[model samples]
Target: MAGGFRRSGQQRQPKLQGKGTLEKMEREGPFKEWLGMPDLYRHTLVIDGDTYTYQVEDAELPFAPGDKVVFRYKEVKSGKWIDRNSLGTWIDPSTYNQ
Candidate 1:
């Protein structure tokens, strides 16, 4: 699926409120490892000068090289794995002012 905005199903309540492309920050520091369902297709993302490939259920994410994503994760102690869902607003590096 091409990167773009995605509308949630009418049945479920929307978690995020906004229109157009939204951006968020990852102030929690770098992630140890990215996680997603195996069946989901993987997408490439660049954050903090690092290239990371991630798989997400929603395809409408505005992800591109050199973009920052606020990564949210769930720690699983029993399985010995870090599961996380990418969050935050998508920011275009080109447009970001230093």
Candidate 2:
């Protein structure tokens, strides 16, 4: 048979659970084994002072390494910390934080 799709029950879908909620952090998180956390929850970013996490799909197009980014931390109703929408801009790293 040519390339075919797996049955509905044969697929393993990932749950998009961010890391802003954790026992070691906020509360005891899901009992996820390894690789359970989505890519969005992988980064533990601490800028200025507060903690922050990235969004999954949005992260695919985000700040790159060595790029000086200007962003603001926004608190969601769920108590999660995230970057303010439309607030991130790329600045010259040479003059950043100076």
Off by over 4 Å in 2: 1-50, 75-80, 92-98
Q: lDDT tens string, model 2, 12-89?
A: 432222222111112222334457554333344544344555443233435443343444445666543555353354
Summing lDDT over every window of 10 consecutive residues in candidate 2, give the lowest-scoring window.
19-28
Off by over 4 Å in 1: 1-39, 63-68, 72-83, 90-98
- Give me the candidate number with maximum lDDT: 2
lDDT of 1 at 81: 18
Q: Residues 1-98, candidate 1, lDDT per residue (tens digit)?
A: 12333464235322332112222312222333346523444444444543344444544555543444455433235321112364555556787996
Task: Work out candidate 2's RMSD over C-alphas.
Answer: 12.8
Model 2, residue 70: displacement in angstroms?
A: 1.5
What TM value does model 1 have?
Answer: 0.32
